[model samples]
Target: MEIRVLGIGCARCNELEKRVKDALAELGIAANVEHVTDLKEIAALGVLMTPGLVIDGKVASQGKVPSKDELKKLLGGGK
Candidate 1:
């Protein structure tokens, strides 16, 4: 799966990326996690938030870092 973390390299953005990786690892799922720091790209996603999580090209969460449990749920829990 393509997991994109959109942010301008802030603390929250880094945290979100790490959490996403942990969640995917816990679920035994291999995913490509990318950090998008480009403003144009982030803006194209229509997110006005600094930290955004995009899973499979769809915006999953924005503005804050979600817990690993929440990320697992957002990823569909391997189902």
Candidate 2:
């Protein structure tokens, strides 16, 4: 699975990436996680806010960080 964290390298953006990594580690699911810092790319993804979470190329969450539990529910168990 591919997960993209869109942000301009702010603290919240970094924290979101950490949370995503933690979630992946907890779930034991291997995914390609990328941090998007380019304004053009972020805008192309239709994210007007930082800390946007994109799973499998589709926008999952925007404007805020999601909890690890919430991430598990969103990503599911065992891939």
Candidate 3:
């Protein structure tokens, strides 16, 4: 599965990435988690806000960070 974290390298974005990683580890799921920092690319995804989460090319979360449990639920669907 592919998971992308969209942000301009902000603190919240970093935290969101970390939580995603942690969630994946705890769930024993292997996914390609990428950090997207380019504004143009992010905007192209219809994300006007930073710290967006994308799962398998689908926008999951926008403008805010998701908790570990939430991430687990989102990522767990990959199984």
Candidate 4:
């Protein structure tokens, strides 16, 4: 799976990326995590907020960092 974290290298953005990685690791999923800081690319996603999480080309979360559990759910985990 491909996961993209969109931000301008802010603290929140970095934290979100780390949380995402931890969540994926817990779920045992191998994903490619990328940080998108380019304005043009970020705008193309139509996100007006920083610290956005995009999973497989679809925007999953934005504005703030979500908890690991929330991320796992977003990744389609749990019973």
Instruction: Report the candidate with higher lDDT, 1 versus 2.
Output: 1
How many clashing pairs does model 3 include? 0
* Positional deviation of residue 51's Cα in model 2 after best superposition, in angstroms: 0.8
Tell me, by TM-score, which candidate is best: 3
The candidate, 3 or 4, that scores higher on TM-score is: 3
Whichever of 2 and 3 has more TM-score, that candidate is 3
Candidate 3 to truth, TM: 0.95
Q: 1-79 in candidate 2: lDDT tens per residue?
A: 9899999988999998999999889888899999999899899999998889998888888999888899887777324
Question: Which ten residues in a row are the worst by lDDT in model 3?
Answer: 70-79
Q: Distance (Å) between predicted and true CA of 51, model 3?
A: 0.4
The lDDT values for all models are 0.89, 0.88, 0.92, 0.91
Candidate 3, residues 11-52, lDDT tens digits: the string is 999999999999999998888999999888899999998899
Pairwise TM-score winner, candidates 1 and 2: 1
Best by lDDT: 3
Once all C-alphas are superposed, what RMSD does model 1 give against the true structure? 1.4
Candidate 1 local Cα displacement, residue 17, angstroms: 0.5
